[model samples]
Target: MTDSSAPPPAPAGPLSGLLVADFSRILAGPYATMLLADLGAEVVKVESPAGDDTRTWMPPVRDEVSTYYLGVNRNKRSVALDLKDAGDLAAARELARRADIMVENFKPGGLRRFGLDYESVSGSNPGIVYASISGFGSGGGASLPGYDLIVQAMSGLMSLTGEPDGPPYRAGISVFDVMTGLHAIIGVLAALHHRAETGRGQHVEVNLLSSALSGMVNHTSAFVAGGVVPMRMGNAHPSLFPYEPLPTADGDLIITAGNDGQFRALCEVLGVPELAGDPRFARTKDRTANREELRPLLVERLKQRPKMEWFHELVAAGVACGPINTVDEGVGFAEELGLDPVVTPGEGDRAVPSVRNPISLSLTPPSYRLPPPALGEHGAEIRAWLAEPTTD
Candidate 1:
């Protein structure tokens, strides 16, 4: 919302001179470009004539704009183009031809018909780092549509998200989509570095299913390496005892004792120091194996105090524990720790509050140059820029 009529001056940061042509929509692609934009990339978000679908995902709105769209579309310019239209498609290809980077989450090979796939675009702009995201890989699973929920279910994440005896559940958020976006960013950065070294660029592909499997980490490893299929254990950790929430007088407090030392510390704080030396709970492996017996003993002491009191006391004793927090409380907790979790982009009237990027770089920190844009907010200017001859 920084008056789209006048482009904001570029900030001094990493990726300052990079031009990103964002042809992606929904969550994964847009989220990646937004982070690139934050890191000082000049991201031009190309949208269909009706705009990105998230623009209408409302009921959670700010100034009548969908917060869902705003959450991942800041610090970027917007251009509406109909890929089916000859004129607009030409303009889009022109944007791609001049971009240093390009990101899209269209179905596998979906952009081929429009001549915007990696092969076609890289043919014209050999240095362009093109990224493609999909639900699955481009080979056998090419035709399958990419959606986070489907990936969660297919990747076995949903099966491990609910209570042991209850039905499966998808995660509370599109975690795999976000993870894929982060992976896409990582791929683009690596490709850019390779381009700098070799004077050539390559296609970087990411899929939700693959990202999901990677994100599953230990759960996926349990099956492949240990021949053990992980199951839903509710709040429990499969390998570590005391790694989940325990009942307190008022509520549950998450406590994690990953090693024997932390377990000893936890026991000391709970006023059950003797439990740490007990044969059944003396070692990390022992505690994990005897968790059914150990859990009730720890819970007995935890229930003697309110969660917050226990939180302060246990944390002070070097035990990892805290009350489960809601989203708002999580932000407040970050604020209380002086992390400044939120940032507002744009100046006055149109400024929108957003979560700060998690990264912190001393030399070139992320910048918030613009708030999210209105549909086609910078179309005229972007089109004019695309019409100019490439300098590189």
Candidate 2:
């Protein structure tokens, strides 16, 4: 007979039936694992006795819980263990051996002493898709700490942010860490595909600095391929005229013209179609090079209308523009567009409002069965599960 009190099985998803041992903390590793958990992987988050560091990153809290911690950690179970303790170390190792995937963000050699490193874990769990996140590669930079702000500075991202005359500033969020996490996920998925065919697994490594350079895209390309180091131009694009926010009657509205057609369309909407054929602004390169001369002409027309009126008219006329929005306004805009950006996970009082995962799968979609857990919330149950003898 079935045990009526037993928990119901996890709802089906694309990654259903997969077990992921997540031994990572903070942004990058936790963010990747949380996404995997959302996709229906059975994620077991192994935390130290003190729990993930973000747990204490308070001030913006929900029910006195850290919203920062809550932001990236959902749909996973937590099991706290002190690797210094023999029993906890055994449990962690056992979980790794049984896991189909394992993720960690320890220093390059930090996990070696605990026997939780890829070499040791993969020896027993040959099919494990092991992912390691670091601030830098496991080269000379390995000795250096891997913080997102540090990466933003060292990777030249800060150099491209802020105004030309202002000091370099890090992005508002941990962008490189998030990018590294995404890169780690791509690596894990690819390695999993390879393992399915070959029945062997490999180590996947991602670092913040590398991900930052890659994420910077065109700016990095400008330097490497063109030997031109891109610099901060405030809200302006280095290669496009009328791409930055311009003054309106009441406020500012961002405008962009990536091609001749868009520039023509913009000029038409501004009731200055003659400017489209002006020798100083007819072509994209010419407009970019002569932006200073072209700016006053466009601004004169833009300043005649309120930003919202211009927003509707420009959008209707097939020109791209929008008002600068706060985060709440951004979410409201998505909601107004029927995007359904927010979701509440868990049940009853434990339910926490979170941003919905951005992916859309027609077949097996993401399922949120658990909220971000309290410290060691699943310790007993997970420990019992790991202690059981495996038939494999």
lDDT of 1: 0.92
Q: After superposing candidate 2 on the true structure, give the runs of residues whose Cα lies further than 4 Å from its correct spot.
A: 1-11
lDDT of 1 at 51: 94
Q: State in Å the error of residue 29, model 2.
A: 0.6
Off by over 4 Å in 1: 1-10
| Clashes, model 2 | 0
Task: Write model 2 residue lDDT over 237-294, tens digit each, in one string.
Answer: 9888879999999998999998999999999999999999999899999999999899
**Which residue pairs in model 2 clash with each other?**
none
Give me the displacement of residue 174 in model 1, in angstroms. 0.5
